[model samples]
Target: MPLQKTLLALEALDSAYVNGESVKQLFGAYPRVTVDVMTVQGEKGSTDFVKVVVPGSEGKRSGGQAPTMGIVGRLGGIGARPSRIGLVSDADGAVAAIAAALKLADMQTKGDTMKGDVIVTTHICPDAPTLPHEPVDFMDSPVDILQMNEHEVLPEMEAILSIDTTKGNRVINHKGIAISPTVKEGYILRVSEDLLRIMEMTTGQLPVTFPVTMQDITPYGNDLYHINSILQPAVATHAPVVGVAVTAQSAVPGCGTGASHEVDIASAVRFAVETAKEFTAGICSFYNESEYDRILGLYGSMRVLQTAGAQTTPAV
Candidate 1:
């Protein structure tokens, strides 16, 4: 199962200097996947964006026109070093995403490749800064939000699954995983039945879902509250985006240590891997295209929500 991949990813990411080079070295055994590392520097420090592509048998790379599914491990940082030690709760997203990539790559090596390509993107930064929040602290990124979206959200991605560690909130009280509704352009559509079925089959429990407000769907730098950066990728692309949240029964600080449950992380990884397989095979759909077209024709566009609006004046 995904337990092996989960452990491998956790061990690899538990280091202080776990950069892209280390990831590249770890995935060297899988020759079917292509790993690329791009280092970007910000005001605080530098973080490496690690992108691993597991090519499908009849995917677009071979001119087969199969849609590509993107799995982005959305997180502030893997570790909040200099402030906190070891792996933080925010690292769950990175770990799960990496584990999914590893499992898919290994499957390819065993002649079980998917029908379309899977692009997995996440960053590696051990010593990231921590920001204060209402209930608890969050692991802030070394770079800004724009830089994060630019690197993680690729244009080739037809649909994106933005997985993040969402235990730092009190809204969702599940102890395993949760999914969000399909967010496209500026509309938050209904949750896909296909995804719900996959989640049930993987976890053998009722599916859990989290709420997304208008403010949450909007981009960062808007001076608004977001549960986390899980849906931030929606601001940069036209593709439908859904958030896969790793949750807890209680609100755990993102900077808290020893909060990541390996079993839950593995469950999320399994869900992602299965979704990647089904989505690319044309057996799953994120949203109804005809309904979306009708909505667009009737109500016009909500694209303005994707940007930061005009600066408001201070109240007298």
Candidate 2:
């Protein structure tokens, strides 16, 4: 199957699950595992080519004493240019699909062996800006704008984990990740200190200063928009994981865009389960001794499951 078709199938499968349909009912006609690639037009400049118009003429002048003239001036084009790329599948097909999309989006990847387990981490710097430029007392720079990108790494990590958590919820928790309440419409999710701390602990990477290039004007008067751009990939990644964590700022535009981001938590959880099943099947195809042994060890401990249950159980 083509990658686009595979993605469409996965998306359809997700939709079916959301609509209260079973996985068998949705994917019964499709092959068990498939790999495909999709190309998306990424960021592009204005598409509308400049059209020159003459200064004096609004309409065609017939038999004019002078020369033919119809207001001539440079005007911005009608459409915007976009980025394009090929994406590959990684682990399970769904994971592959999710990973492919993230990779296409230019997200960064890092992995390390921790306690003999390979922990893969993906990161992306999201653009977010605070409006009205609140001043930091005693600061010389634009404090609000400065703070916006100062913790870029943190939000990127959150987005990565949010994707991971959402995917995990689909497989394990059977719940959709909740959006953080701090975000509002038009504004993208911002990195918080807590998220940064988590990433530092997980990857054992030293804290680096955030870059300055990512700052941008807030789209709406009060809210930012770059975080919203990542919603699709975030949800896509979460589709295969057990659970996802989303900040309140990630906005899902209306249905007109042909993309759906607003998903019911319960339905998202179910989709994650089905997605996990597909992922497991894909992973099984290329299994190795180490991978098998690790998976076995991970699942072998009933104590772990029980402990997890206990941890999540509400206190009586």
Candidate 3:
């Protein structure tokens, strides 16, 4: 069901010259869906940051009262290029995010519009560099984490689902998709039952979840060992962030070609789309307001964790 859109996005990204304009054209047919692309320059190179908005009938973009939900496709790059031949494993997050955006656009045309606007953000880079890591190599982005957060983590987003390829690690051995616990203001909260339920319905199997450590939620460039950049958005926003990881049983390098699986990526797409439906309708919540308030009152603000610690190097 979601494959049609997923494959469409894959075809769009599996190119040597893919850019913001090329991706923006995908939504030109839909009058309600608005797509925006900005080309940003970084140290290594540049990448196109793309945002697609699927407006809901009562969404705030139209001056309505409904909340806005954000879906960020977090990845370093779609391809390692010359060093790699084709679409690499890191590309799955972007594919799934774009596919979800396309599906939402199609749904709006067919009278399936949601109650609130859905904003999806992701960057496209055909050829990105690779960084050495412990278990495997990572798909290094053209921009640093700060640049990525600045473009992708919009303040308008009330809640965010960060989708990324989390395969280049020893943890999360499942071959399908996995979700991380709700992370907010440097606190790693319990897994959302609502999200788990949606995952079960979408995947038709038990919900799979990955672990998040204190260091994982902190900003990168601290010289700490993070699982990956899957939860990097958490460090940039006060909004509750959840990571939707495209995983594998083995430690697969992010730069490894021929490792992307369409079906598994589709599974993540389904989960995100369903969560958007429920989240906007007031039927699903990422974190409990009262519980979070209680924790905050008892422990004070944990927002310091959002910043680079004292005497740390400038954020790369």
User: What is the per-residue lDDT of model 3 for residues 81-112, given as tens digits with 9 covering 90 to 100?
Assistant: 88998899999999999999999899988889
lDDT of 2: 0.22
True-structure lDDT of candidate 3: 0.93
lDDT tens digits by residue: candidate 1, 1-316: 7989999999999989889999888889988789999999999898999999999988998788888999999988888887798999999999999999999999987879899999999999998898898677888999999999999999989999999999988899899999999999999999999999999999999999999999998988888999999999998999999999999999999999899899999999999999999999999898889989999999988887778866787789
State the C-alpha lDDT per candidate: 0.92, 0.22, 0.93
Checking candidate 1 for backbone clashes, the offending pairs are none
User: Candidate 3: worst 10 consecutive residues by lDDT?
Assistant: 307-316
lDDT string for model 2 (128-153, tens) is 11112221101011122222222211
List candidate 3 segments past 4 Å from native. 312-316
- Which whole-number lDDT from 0 to 100 does residue 217 have in model 1? 88
Off by over 4 Å in 1: 314-316
Best lDDT goes to which candidate? 3
**Cα lDDT for residue 35, model 1?**
95
**Candidate 2 residue spans exceeding 4 A from truth:** 1-85, 88-191, 209-217, 220-316
Q: Which pairs clash (backbone N, Cα, C closer than 3 Å) in model 3?
A: none
RMSD of each: 1.2, 25.2, 2.4
